[model samples]
Target: MRTRPVLKATEPWEKLVWWPKVMYEEGRYRLWYEAVPPDHWDPEIGPKLAWPNPVFAGLLCYAESEDGFTWTKPELGIGSWDGSNETNISLGRETVGPMGLHGASPFMDPDAPPEARYKMFWYGDATPDVVKAARRERPDAIDPRTTDESHVRAMYVGTSPDGLNWIVQDKPAVVFSSDTLQVVEWDALRKQYVWYGRGWSWGRRTITRAETTDFSRWPLPQDVLTASPINPEQTDLYTNGKTRYPGDPTTHLMFPTLYDRATDQTTIGMATSVDGVAWNWTPGNPVLPVGSPEGVDAGSMFVGIGLVPLPGDRIGLPYAGYSYPHKFPANLADSGFSWCTWTRGRLAGVHAQTEGEFRTPPVRLAGSGLRVNCRVQSGGSLRVGVTDEEWSEIPGLGVSDCQPITGDQLDATVRWSGGSKLPVDRAVSLHFSLRTASVFGFEILDER
Candidate 1:
C-alpha cells in the first residue's frame, strides 16, 4: 500500500522527524515522534557530545489530530530548547537527563492506576552500574567499546498521568541495547507484559521477544524472528512494528522493516502469528515497497507501531519516509511522517484465479452464523460449506445449498438455502470454494 504524507518537518527542532507511536483515546488521536535538531548532526558540535549514538540521538515530541489524516503539533512548554520552552518537545536531554530520548513507545496501561495510566518504554544511555552488571552477566550481548560514559545503552521505563508529562524510573528496565523501537503491550489473555525489540542472529539484525508478569522487571530477550534462508542473501530485519488486530486478541500482526545491505535501502514486510511469539511471513513479501527513484520515500521507510482504525471501515498504518538511503549522511537526509491504509480486515487474502477450494481445520462452533470478508469479480463467485472432522459434508450445509456470493462486501453473511443457523455445541470445519474471487477472512457471528 502506498502512503499519503500527513506530517512534515516544520520547526527548527524538527529538522528530521520519524519513529511515530500513535494512540486513539478520548475521541482524539495522539502521536509521539522522534525529532532531531540540526545541531545533533552538525560536524563542528556533533562530535563534542558523541552525537548520533544510536541510543542518544533524538527528542520525543508530541502531536494530535481529530481525524487521523490531519495533525497538529501543540506547544506544551515541556522541554526547553534554544533558551525557550515554546516547542512541543515532551522529553529531551533536559527532561530525560544525560541519556536523552531515542525511540519512545508509549501505551495506555489498562491495569494501572490513574496516576500511572500512561506508560512508555524507551532506549537511552545506561548508568555505569547497570552497564557494569550487564557486561559481567552477558558479555556477548554488550558492545565491546561501551563504557560508563559512552555508547553503553539500555531500555528504560517511565510513567505519566497524562501523555505529555512523565516520571522516569531510576534504573534501566533491560540492560541490552535494542537499538530500535522497543514495543511493549499488556497481553490480557496471557496476563503478562510482552515485549518485542531488536536482536542479533546469524550476524544480522532480527526481531526478539520477552515476557514478564511484572512490567518493571524484564528478562533478557531471545530472538524469535530471524532472517531465514528463504530471504534475499544480503537482507536483515531492522525494526519490529508489532501490533494486535483491533477487537481481536487471537491475531498478532507485525510489519518489520527489511534492510537491504546491497542497496542500502529498506522496505516493509508483513507477518502474522497466533501467539505473538511464533511468526510466519505472509505471501507477497515487501507488501509496502519504496517509491520511484525521484519520489519522496524512494530511499527508505519505517512503519510505525500502531494499526489505527479510521472512519469508513479503514485501517491506517503510520510510517516514516526518507528521500535518501538508509546509510545516507544524516545532515543531507530528508524525512517526514505519513500513513498507508487497507480495507478493514483485508491485510491478507486467499485468491483463486480460475477455481480453488480449501478447508479449515476443525473448530468448535462458538457462534450461530458465519460472515466473510471477500470480493468476487464480475465473472466470479464464492460459497461456503460445513464439514465434519472426517471431511464429510454436513447435511443442509453443503456447497450446493449455499447461495453464491457475487459482490464485494466487508462483512457479508454466508447464507444457505436450507438454513442460515449453525450448531454451536459441536466441532466442525469450514470449506471455502472460489472462482475468480478473493476471501480476506471470516468470522463466526453470534446472532443472539
Candidate 2:
C-alpha cells in the first residue's frame, strides 16, 4: 500500500474526517465526506457538552476534481458553522440542522428525474428531543459508549440535481433499533435500491442488508454478512464499504472493517456477493490491513464508501485514517483521510507459484471476444481455451491454439488461432493455463 493519504484534515477547525463517498460523472469527480469541526455544537448546547461528546457533530462536505486525484473543496456557503460560513459545507447548519450532517452516501441516477438525479442516504437528526422520546420507547436505543442513543437515528434520503445543493426528503427512509453506518446504492442489476448498515445478531456487531423497490417501503433487514466463526471471539464487522463491480454489474464488492474490540484494532476485509443481500467473505486476513502500532489508522481504518476508478484498470479506495483510541475523545490531532487501490477485476485473484490453471463458471456472452488482466513473469506464459460444462476443450479455441500471453497488462485480449469465438450459441466456460503468471480476471466484451 502507498504510505501517504490522498486527502488530509488541514483546516484549523477540522477535527476529523471519515466515510468518504465518491462519484465520477460528466467528466468530473464529486466527493461527499463526513467532516466534524472542533466546535460543532450549537452555542446553546456548547456548555452542556461536558462529556467527550462531539461539540458540533459532522457536517457533510463536498469536493470536486477534474481528475479524481487532485481534489478542491470549493466553498459552497450554503451552511453556517462556528459563526462562519467559510467551509465547503454541502448540507448542515441552517440547511438541514437540528441533527447537522452524518453519513451522506451519495449516488447519481441518470434514470431519476432531473431534480433528483443525485441522491444521498444519511443518518442524523438525533436531537435531544428526538432521543429522549426514542429512549422512552426503547431504553437501549443508542450506544452510550459513543454518544447519546436518544437521537432519532433513522435513515433519511436527500436529493440534489448537481450533487452540491440538496433537497432532503420529508419522510425518513429506514428506521433502526440502533445507530450504525448506513450506505445506499442503486442496484441496476436488480433494478432496486439496496441498503447496508449495522445490524446486531449473535450478540455482536454483524452486518445486515435490505432492498427496496421504492425508497420508502423497505422490508426488515436480514443478516447477510457476519463475522466468520474462525475469527476471534470479539471479531465484528464495523462498516460496509460496498460498491458494485464496474465491469461486472452482477457482482458486488465491499471493504468491511473487521473490528476486534478485544484487541482494539481495526483492519479492512473483503467480501463479495452476486446479489447485494448475501455475501461471501474472503478468508485468511485483511485485504487492506491496518497501519503499524502508533501509526495513523492504527487504531481504526475504514475504507471509502465509494470505490472510484483509477489508472491501470484499477479501483481507487479513498479511506479515512485514525490513530489509537479510535474514539471521539481528546480530539486525536492526526486523524484524516487517505487512499489505496486494488488491481482492476482482481481485488481477489488466484496465484500460481509455477504452473497452474483455473476454470471459470459457465457464461453465455453478448460478445465472444475475451479481454483479460494477467501478469506473466519473464519466462512465463498464459493460455485460454473454451471448455464444455464437462471440461472438454472445443476445437480451434483449444489451449494448444492459444497465442501465448507473455506480458503484463490490464486489458490484454485472449486469443486463439481462429480468434476464440464460441463455436455454439449455448453456455460455455473458460479454462485458463498459467506458467509463472497470474490471470486476474476476464470479461466478455459487450457487443457494441
Which runs of model 1 end up more than 4 angstroms from their true locations?
52-56, 127-130, 133-150
For residues 368-393, write the lDDT of model 2, one tens digit per residue.
Answer: 67888888899999998888878788
The candidate maximizing lDDT is 1
Clashing pairs in 2: 40-56, 41-55, 41-56, 126-151, 131-150, 131-151, 142-149
TM of each candidate vs. truth: 0.94, 0.87
Please count the clashing residue pairs in each candidate, in the order shown. 0, 7
TM-score of 2: 0.87
RMSD over all Cα atoms, model 1: 2.3
Candidate 2 local Cα displacement, residue 50, angstroms = 11
Q: Which stretches of candidate 2 lie over 4 Å from their true place?
A: 40-56, 126-152, 177-180, 217-219, 293-295, 328-330, 418-420, 446-448
Tell me how candidate 1 scores on lDDT: 0.83
Error of 2 at 406 (Å): 2.0
